[model samples]
Target: MVSDKNSEYKFTGGNSLTGIHKLYHEVMMLNELWNGYGAYEVSYAAGKSGISFGGNQMDMHDNKKTAEKFTNILISATDNAGKHFFTQGEVKMIVGNEFVNLIQNGEVVLSMLGDNLASINAALSSVYGRARIDQLYVSEIKNGAEHIEKVIEKITNAAAKKFYDSDLGRVLLFDYHNQYDLKFDGRFLADYINGKGKENFSTKEMVVAPRDHSKYRAIC
Candidate 1:
């Protein structure tokens, strides 16, 4: 009977030890699983954030490119026509008695007068012959200036609307806080879209304001 009690105690203690070992092994397995899942979650979140940010940048870049292209097209068309009309009648005159005399013995005179105000008036009359020069000049000053102003206004309005309607604009106006160190309130984008934005900011005031005119004059 004593031997039986001792055997029972040994068996019970051994079973308890086995149970503790099994519990520890289960806990270790669960911890490994949780850590693996956590690593995967972290990687996925990082990838998703990167993709979102990159997409926004690319979209903004494309919007700016399109705006620039449209601006260039309008500017090129108007500038080219203005330049041609202004320089079309340029001419030069040469005076000499004979070819050999002009070359060695005689003097020659060269004159260029097509770019004078009188020549320009004549050319303008020829192109717009139905109207008087004075009348045309007045029309150009009033009606022509108004037309060009309207064109510029249209281009600027369209560009501002397009930029503000874009996803990047929403993010910049709402999500990002520091845009080039300017404290942009949420309404800046809206105001610019509505043609009420401020126009007093200078792009080169710091670098050009106090410099010598001869040293910092624009080349073009």
Candidate 2:
């Protein structure tokens, strides 16, 4: 067991271990994109995390059985200028189908937006034109901001409420924590590394390599 004094430090190590893995994957994707197609945003809406994409996506995939295990372990190792040091309760296990629900809600929102694109665009244009006119007459440029804000809030709140009332949203918001607590095993690191050495710490079969490496050349 990790001592209380060292828990925070241990957690930091675990966090970094997972963080590097994520950065590695992200860079790999960026490199691929750079080599082939020019920069472009993916069409995936709020992938893994609906409202906050970057914050939550980092943790969602790191806790898988096939992925690196860190959170539940009693001790963690870190590379400090090529030298390794240990810290102690640094394992983190996150469990929940939050990503799945986010995708479901995101799809609903996207579909709603697509269906009402014409009306939405018209309303936005109207607001912009009104604001521009108001600017010419008023001392402050924000003279018509309140009107536009209210209109936007009304439309956005309605759409958000629809998501909140859905079955997936209700379950994700209310029931996920209570029902899937076991899914996140903070002690997973300890369990996984019982007889393992640091050299064997890498995630095993985490990514399925291409069958024909030569055939998978970057389309530069």
Any runs in candidate 1 off by more than 4 Å, and if so which?
Answer: 1-110, 114-131, 155-220
Alpha-carbon RMSD, each predicted model = 39.1, 27.3
Which tens-of-lDDT digit does each residue in 24-60 have in candidate 2?
A: 3233223222322211111222444221111111122
TM-score of each: 0.16, 0.19
Put down candidate 1 lDDT per residue, 1-220, tens digits, no spaces: 0101111111111112233233322332232223212110100112112100010111111233322321222222222235432321122111112211112211111112222433322332232321222232233223322332333233334544344333333223222221121132323332333344444356522221212333222321
How far residue 86's Cα lies from its native spot in candidate 1, in Å, is 23
The TM-score leader among the candidates is 2
Model 1 clash tally, residue pairs: 0
Give the C-alpha miss distance for residue 77 in model 2, angstroms: 42
